[model samples]
Target: MNFRQKNVLLILLACFPFGLIAQAQKKKSKVVTDPVFSAFSYKGNDAIYTDNPLKADEFYNPILQGCYPDPSITKKGNDYYLVNSSFSMFPGVPIFHSNDLVNWKQIGHVLDRRSQLKVDSAGISAGIYAPDIKYNPGNETFYMITTQIASGIGNMVVKTKDPLKGWSDPKKLNFDGIDPSIFFDDNGKAYITHNDAPDRGKTLYNGHRVIKIWEYDLQNDQVIPGTDKIIVDGGVDITQKPIWIEGPHLYKKNGKYYLMCAEGGTGGWHSEVIFVSDSPTGPFKPAPSNPILTQRHFPKDRKDKVDWAGHADLVEGPDGKYYGVFLGIRPNNQDRVNAGRETFMLPVDWSGEFPVFENGLIPMRPKLKVPKGTERKWEQGGYFQNGNFTFNEDFSKDTLDFRWIGVRGPREEFIAKTKDGLIIKPSERNIKSNKVTSTLFHRQQHNAFEAAFTLKYAPRSATDMAGLVCYQSERFNYVFGITRKGTEDFLVLAKTNKGETTVVASVKIDTGKPVRLQVVANHDEYRFNYSTDGTNFQNLGGTVSGDVLSTNVAGGFTGSLIGLYATTGNDIQPQ
Candidate 1:
C-alpha cells in the first residue's frame, strides 16, 4: 500500500469507533433543543346534541365525525369494516368495525408503519387519498386499496387476515389514478377500478374525468397488463358534461352488475350516481333515478345544513337490508367548512332492482330512527362520534389513540411515553413547515368545541416554545403557546393565513408549575385563553374571526387540527 493510503486508512480507523458519543448523537439530534410537554387534554361541547336529545329510537346522522371522509365499507359475515381517507396524516386510512352498522368503533389505521406510508415530505393534502377496504370472501382475506399521491406510489393495496391485529405492507399496482377499489365477483374473479384522466388524448370539457376498470390477479396482487377499459366516460350523460366522476365501487345485485360513482367534483356540486351493466366491464347505463344522493339542489341557508354530499360506498347490513356510507359536511352558521368532510350513514332502499340511498336525495336530517334489531347503545355519550360527545386523551398508555395523529412522520420520532403523560420532544420544524414537526393532532370535531392542553415546560432559547395549535393547514392556522423573548417568557397567540403569520395577542407569564392553554370556537369566532392556576382562566385574544381556518378561506381539503405542539422555530413574538 502507498504511504498516503496507509495514513488515510489509519485516520478512518481512528474515527470508526461508534461508541457512547456516537450512540447519544444518533438518539437525539443536536439541533432539537425544544422542551418536552408533560400532559395534554381535549374536549368537545357542541350545542346540537344538547338541544336535540336522542330519543329511545333515534341516533345521529354522521356515524363518524371530524375530518374523516371518503368512506368505503365491506362486510365479512356479521362483522363490517369501514375506512376513510386520511390525506397526509402519518397513519393513512383510518379503519372501523361495526356489527349492526349503527355503533362503529375505530380499529386503527391501515398504513401505520412509515415504510408503508411514505408521506414524510408530502403536503398535508397530497399524501393519501380515498381509501377503500373490502373483504374478499373468496380468499378469506381483507384488502385496502388507496392512492398514495406521494413517493411515486400511485395506487396500492394491502391485506390482512384480521384488522384488529394489523395490516400488511402495501403492494404497488401498475396504474395511474387517485381513488382505487377492488371487487370480487361470485365466480372467483376480481377487478380493480379507479378514477383516471380521459383516454390519452381527447377533447375534454371542464373537469372531464373517467372511471377505468382492470382485471385484478388475486395471487399476484396486481392488475393484469392490457386488461384495462374505461367503464364510465364523462359521467351520467356525456352530453350533460359531468365532472370528477370518481370513487367508483361495483356491486352485483339480483344478477346485475351495479356501478356507483360520485359525480361532479368533491365540493358543492357533488352527487352520487348509479349505473347498470350486464357485465362487469361493458357499456354501463345510468339509472333514470340518476343522482341517487345529493344536497346541492337545496337552499344554502337551510337549518342544520349538511352539504357537500357524495363519494359513497354501499354494504349490506346484518338485517338483510342494504346501507350506504358516504362523505358529507355540515357548514357552520357562516357557511364555512372548518370541520372538513365527515362520514355519514344512511339506509339504502333497494326494493327495486337498483339500490337508492334513502333520504339521501332530500335535505339531510340531524337524526335518524334506529333500525329494528340494531342495538341503541351508541346513543350514550363519551364516544366521539354520532351526536355531540366528549373525548379526552391522557397519553398515559404506551400506544397512542387512533384519533391522535401526526402529519408526515411517526409519532415515536419526537415522543416519549411516561407515567405522567406524553412527552413531545420539540423539533426545529414549526407548524407551518411542510416537514414533520413535534405535534400530535386531533381533528376539530365540531363547530362549537373546546380544546386545551396542560403543559409544564421551560424554554432555554428564545426560539423554544410548547403549547396548543388550532391547525387548518401549514399556511392557515393559529398557535397559542408560551414562547421566550430575550430573557423573558410570554404567552402568545398567533395566526397564519395564506402563509403570512402575525401575533394577535401576547402577555408576560411566569409559572413554575403546569400551565393550561385553551381555544374555544363558537361558529365563526374563536378565543384563546390561558390559565396559570388550574381553575381560573383568562382570555388573551378576545374574539378572532375563524374565516382563515375555513375551507372557504383556506382553500384546502382538510379540516382544522387541534394539536399539542412543541417547536424551536417559534415565530410569533411577544408584544
Candidate 2:
C-alpha cells in the first residue's frame, strides 16, 4: 500500500457522491474497446428436427421460428392471443401468449413505443405488414389491426383490455390497404376487413385484390363514416386471375359470415381461401373448398418441404379444437428461402360447412398431433421449440429479451446493458442503412443453425465495424466483423448481393483478444467463422451462398435476419 499510500487512497475515493456514480459507470464501461461480446449462442440443427423426433404425441411445425410471418390469431376465454409479421423490425408487432394452444409465450410488442412504430425510414421490406389479433367478446376488447408502412402509418389500430398488460398507442386506421381484419359481431356489430383495390378504376387482373368491409366505430375506433363494404371480390375467383388477394380473416362461425382470404402472390402461388356471409356486409360465398389452405399443389421436391402456404388465422382451441394460424415456407438446398416466414399450426376441420386445414391438403408434415388434453406434457417448459433447440443469451439482463430485436431504430437507440457485455453503440448508420443502425436482430431461427458470439471488439477505424449479420434486407446481407485494415486488425468476410459488396474473406485479427463470431447455416451453405482461443475455431468464409438469404432471393416478405452488427459507417473490405 505504498505509492504515496496509493495516491492518498485514490484521492480519498474520488470525493464521494457515490464516488461520482462510480466514475460514470467506469466511463460507461469503456464504450467497448476490446473483449466485447456479451454472450450469445443459438443452436437449432433442423434436419426436419433431426429427421423427425418429438413424439409424446407430436407437435412442432414452426411454432414461431425465424421471420415469424403473417400469422394472426385470437381467443379470449381460455386465453390465446398471437400475432407476427414485424416488417421493418424494431419492435413492430410480435405478441404471443397461450394456454395450451401448443404452449407459446412471448408477451410483448404490440408496436412497442417510438410513437407506436414509425419504422424510422422504412424499408427492410418496409415496416410492419399483416398483423391482426382480435377478440371482441362484444367489448371485452383487444384488437391489433395493422399495416404501418412507415412514417405516414397506413392502416392501424391498437387496443388492449389486457394482453398480459400492454398495448394501445397507435389508432390511425382510416385505412388504405394491406391485410386489416377486425370483426366482432353478435348484435354488438363491428367490422373492418381489409386488402383493397378493384373498385377504383374497376381494374381486373394483375393480382386485382379487393375485400373491404368497414362500419367499425367501436365507440369511435374509426372506420364508420361511409360504411365501406366490398367483401370478397378478387379472391376465391376473380375468374382465376386472382393474384395477391391479401390476408383477410373475418369470422362468426355457426351463424355464418366467414370471409378468410390470402390468395396467391405471397410467392410460389400462396393461398388460403374461403368466403361465405349472411351479413357483416358481403354476398361473400365461394368455397367449393376453395383453397382451404394450399402449398400450391405440392411437389417442389417435397421432403420436409413446406412452401409459401398462406396467411391464415382462426382460433378456437382450448380443446374445442379449430385452430389454424398460418404463413409457411422452409426451403433451402436451393429451392431458396432462408428461415423467413414461419409460424404454422394446423387443425381446423369445423365439421363440414367450410374450414379444412387439418393437415391441409397434404405435403406439409413437420409433425403435429398432440391435442389430447391440449399439450399433454409438452416436455417441461411446456414446449416452445424449433426442433433441435438451445438459445442462450445473457447481456446481463434487466430487459432486452423479447428475443432481441431492432432494425429501423430504437433498441433504446443503440443498446447498453453493462456489468460488462451488451453495449453495442456503434451506429452512425451501416448495415446498409435504410436508417436505423446499431443492428441487433435475431430471427434466422434455423435451416440448420449454429450461431455464436462472445465479443470484445476493437475496430477504431476503417470506419469501425462490429460483427455478425446475415440479414436479408436493407439489400441482402452477411458481413462478419472486426475492421481496421491499415495498422492491422482484420477479420472481414463481407458478401451483400443486391446492394453490392464482396469481401469474401480476410484475417490478421487479435482485436485485443476475446472474439468468437460464428454463423453456420448449412441449408444451402453459408459459413464464416473466427475465434481467438474461445476454443480454437477458424474458417473465414468458405461455404457461402444461402442465396443471399433467400425470400425467393431476397425480394422480401422477410425471413432470415441474423444481426448483432455495429457500425460508424464501415464500408466493408477484404477481397
* Candidate number achieving the greatest TM-score relative to the actual structure: 1
Clashes of each: 0, 6
Model 1 compared with the native: what TM-score?
Answer: 0.93
The root-mean-square deviation over C-alpha atoms between each candidate and the true structure, in angstroms, is: 6.8, 20.1
lDDT of 1 by residue, 192-243 (tens): 9999999778748978999999999999999999999999999999998889
Q: What does the lDDT come to for candidate 1?
A: 0.87
**lDDT (0-100) at residue 472 of candidate 1?**
85
Q: Looking at model 1, report the run of 10 residues with the lowest lDDT sum.
A: 30-39
Candidate 2, 499-533: lDDT as tens digits: 99888878888866778888887797878887788
